[model samples]
Target: MHGRCISCRFFANDPALIEATFPGLNVLSSAYGSVRSDAGICSRHEFFLSSWQRCRDFESGDNEGKDALLPVEKKLIGYSIGFGAVLLGILVWISYTFFPTGH
Candidate 1:
């Protein structure tokens, strides 16, 4: 059995990303926290597993459909932008109404 979970292929659906980040996870994927922070459903164990987790049932899997996905971060970024825009609009309206120019 491979000592490292990353070598077991069950490590990540997108194994390439895991491999690339394994060397320098601290510098590359710092925004998402640790490399192991990424979690996915492990087919072998029929449960979720972190990228850094290892198990006896680990087996090689393909990465055809799997992608280096970051859905949560994407959604959060979208929501933040939307909320900021709304706040900026409100600020502009408030300033215009309270500080009307003398015409």
Candidate 2:
């Protein structure tokens, strides 16, 4: 598991009870269910995993840490920003090259 169930919003200290009572509520089919050692279940997404694997549904943690974009996400954002800046620079250069600068 990527994150610890101890901190998840849907995390129950004991999943066997909740899981047994509520079927299909928190299925392990999604988000790679947690290991057996982790008794708690993510009630929201019904996921379980080692707190060290990779938590995609873990919520209720520090906003800064929980909200930080993944490496691939960050790369995409960086690429977009860089592309925008370059595009703006190109437009400015074109304006200077083709259009007369008042100054």
Off by over 4 Å in 1: 1-69
Off by over 4 Å in 2: 1-66, 101-103
What are the per-residue Cα lDDT tens digits for candidate 1 across 1-103?
4343544555454545545535675465542445545565454566546556667675655433446658998899999999999999998888889877832
The best candidate by lDDT is 2
Model 2 per-residue lDDT tens digits across residues 1-103: 5555566666664555646655785664422245445454556766554444346666764322455678999999999999999999999888888886643
What are the Cα lDDT values of the candidates?
Answer: 0.60, 0.61
